[model samples]
Target: MNIDFTLEKYKTLCETISNSSYTTFTFEQYFNQENPPKNCILLRHDVDRNISNAHKMAMIEQRLNLVSTYYCRTTERVFKPEYFQEIAAMGHEIGYHYETLDKAKGDVEEAIKIFGQELNAFREFINIKTVCMHGNPFSPWLNSNIWNKYDFRDFGIIGEPYLSLDYKDVIYLTDTGRTWADKNIRVKDVIKDKDHQKNNLLIGNISTTDDIINLIKEEQYPRICLLAHPDRWHGHLIDWTGELILQNLKNIGKAGIIWYRKNKN
Candidate 1:
């Protein structure tokens, strides 16, 4: 099989979706639509680390006339105002990929406060209508937990995928752990919808970008939210190879952590 996580494959995947019967929409567009199209794709990118990679993906999608939502973390390195503005200018939605709880060290009040600050900061670049949690695997705290004490809706946010979207309606597929089938390394990216699991929907059935394209061609699901991390898809040989090596090391560490937690419980 050819290399799957390359920019060529990524562009092919986008082209497949673009050529399909399904219409692609940004998360904000999908959420605001009174009557969404029957077969649709909500293309979302979680900009966890590399802003440049996210920008590249955004440009590709824009050239294809496809819009996607990009959730950016407010870390010093990842939060680039110019890049965010560029993505928004390309007609992509910009959202906050918040990890305030972990940053707050599990203080709910502090987390909520920090979240507001970060959200406001991001707004200076683009109008952020949605927010997504950044699951810090090493932290004991889940960033989504901040909502348990305070609602994001209060902050003018319309949606948070993990909290807002019904998995029963939209099939959630994420490239966590570098492969769609590997659930062990995923910390908070999994969906908890029982119906989705019982039906054996798209979870374990997909492994590569090609698998996703085939499924779309078959019209396997009514709607899908394809979550991709830009850092994983690189065109340059050195950068791509480096990411592969780094992810492998990270995966081993994540596996160890998962095993320790399972055994402890």
Candidate 2:
């Protein structure tokens, strides 16, 4: 069996969503609505590095008549205002993938100030109602921790998945470390409840895109939050192979880090 992260596979995933009873929603739409459908899939894209890949994914979703939320990082490589505008013009929600805590070197005040500035800058492209933390895996500071000292609601942000979404109610799945069910390599892009996940039989069963499509076909979970990094999904064979090699190297490094953290404690 061969499984590759290509545009075709992504389209298959979207088709599965279309065929199922699950209603697709952007993060803003999911939070703002008073009473959304019980069975819904919250599709989110975190544009960590590649801007073009993000646009491709957004176009794919738009072609399926699906509106998903895209979080853009304000990095030199990923921050493209025109791309953000293009994606937002397709009726997708645009948001900030913030890394202010890491950028500010754990300074809460500085992080908050930077956050405000970046949020305002992003609003110039689209009305951003939600923000998500960009997990700087190698950094000592967690971006989500900034909320402990300050509130996002004060900034007119409606929701942050790590803070607002309850894992008990919604099953969270992220394509971190280039694969699903590889939580050991994930730094901060994971649900907090490990015990609950272990108890849930369907939690670790899905590993690939096909696994997720099958789950959707089976109607396994009523509510699912699918988090995808567009940089990992590529159309070209060379690019796909390169990403796989790079992610494998990163996975080994992350595994070592996890081991060190456990033994040190």
Each candidate: how many clashes?
A: 0, 0
Q: Cα miss at 107, model 1 (Å)?
A: 0.4
Per-prediction TM-score: 0.95, 0.95
Model 1 off-target regions past 4 Å? 201-204
- Check candidate 1 and list the clashing pairs: none
lDDT of 1 by residue, 73-159 (tens): 987878999999999999999999999999899999998889889888988767999999998777888889888879888999989
Q: Which ten residues in a row have the lowest lDDT in candidate 2?
A: 195-204
RMSD, candidate 1, Å: 1.5
Off by over 4 Å in 2: 194-201
